[model samples]
Target: MLWVKAFHILFVVSWFSGLFYLPRIFVNLALEKESVSRERLLLMARKLYRFMMMLSVPAVLLGAWLLWLQYGGSGSFKMPGWMHAKLTLVILAIGYSHACGAILKKFERGANTRSHTWYRWFNEVPVLMLLAIIILVVVKPF
Candidate 1:
């Protein structure tokens, strides 16, 4: 269980690293005016999005594993309110990741219409999610 917990933490952190940076790349992509630079930024965003997907899969699976263990592998245990809240945030984070992919697709198709400032604000979402998740896990605030 400890090993699973450790790896869950590892994968979550790894996944969040990409979540934190990918939007910053979007900000640059929004700001870039030169065709060459735009293409470069798009390439970076594509690769990072793929890598984020890779990290997120294991993070989510390991999280589900932890939840299963919490249930004593029999769905007989009662989870605290905080765990439910954390799961909500996790789902939102996954949605946010998918949103990023959609935004990347828009950028790829030359259909992006948002400003760099918008993306800058978007970049803070994962930071806030991370904070809330950590608080829920550590403080277990119900």
Candidate 2:
């Protein structure tokens, strides 16, 4: 169970690495306004997004399972305030991911230029979310 938790953390970290970087790439892609560069950036964003989807969802599920294990997988699992906050942030992170997917679909339809400002703003979303997640996980700040 500890091993599973460790692996979940590893995957989460890896997924977050992509999450932090991909939006910056999207920003660059939006700024470039060049066909070739945009194509490359879009390709990179798509690939990184796919990797994040493959990694983070299962990692989150495993983390949830580990939380369940803390209470022996029964309804007796008492969550701290910070854990609840962390869960809210996790759900928000998932929402941001869905937003990214929507942006990707727009990109696929050549609507990328219209979403430049939103993409730039999206670049900052994960940083704050990651901060909250780290605080919740480490300091358990309620």
Candidate 3:
């Protein structure tokens, strides 16, 4: 279980590295006017998204494993309010990740209508999510 928790932390950190970076790429992508620069940014965004998604799979699986270990399965598990809130925030974070992928596609197709300002705000979503998640887990303030 200790090993599981450690690996979960490792993979979560890996996923977060992408969550922190890909949006900055979007900000640069939005600002880039040169074809060469745009193409490079697109390539970086695509690779980072793929790598981050790979990390997320392990993170999610390990996290679920920990949860199951903590609470057991099915009706045996009783969730605290803090855990519920943490999960809701996690769902929001996943939605944001999907939104980033969609936005990345729009950038790739040169169909982006959003300004760099939009992406700058968009970049803050994960930061807020991370903060809330950490607080929920550490404080468990229900």
Candidate 4:
């Protein structure tokens, strides 16, 4: 259980790093025309998305497993209101990550060119999600 928590924290950090950078890749892709540079941007986006799928998903799963072990239907573990808020933030974060992944798949398939406006709005999603996650972890509002 201790090992699980340790790895969870480490991989969560890595996952957040990928999430933070994935949007920047989208922003870059939006700015460039559909040329060789666009291919490069797509490659970057795909790589980041792949990293998230491979790394972040497992990390999050392990976390949920640990939480279940600790708190799921167990009188030994009690969850407070603040922890519930944190769990909500985590779910949102996971959703945002999946959305980014979908966008990356579209980019990889050479789908419609995204406008800067689109990228900018999408970029805010991760940032806002990150802020929520941070608050959930640190402030832990009840």
Which candidate leads the pack in TM-score?
1
Q: Could you tell me every candidate's TM-score relative to the true structure?
A: 0.97, 0.88, 0.96, 0.82
Best by lDDT: 1
Question: Across residues 1-142, which tens digit of lDDT does each residue of candidate 1 receive?
Answer: 8999999999999999999999999999999989999998999999999999999999999988888887757758788899989989999999999999999999999999999999999999999999999999999978
Clashes (backbone N, CA, C under 3 Å), per candidate, total 0, 0, 0, 0
Off by over 4 Å in 3: 73-75
Global local distance difference test of model 2: 0.82
Cα deviation of 56, candidate 2, in Å: 1.1
Q: How many backbone clashes does candidate 3 have?
A: 0
Decide which is better by lDDT, 2 or 4.
2
Query: Whole-model lDDT, candidate 4?
Result: 0.80
Candidate 2 residues 26-98, lDDT tens each? 7777677688988898889899999988888887888878887876467787778998898899888888887
Minimum summed lDDT over a 10-residue window in model 2 is located at 107-116
- Give candidate 1's error at residue 31 in angstroms: 0.6
Q: TM-score of predicted model 2?
A: 0.88
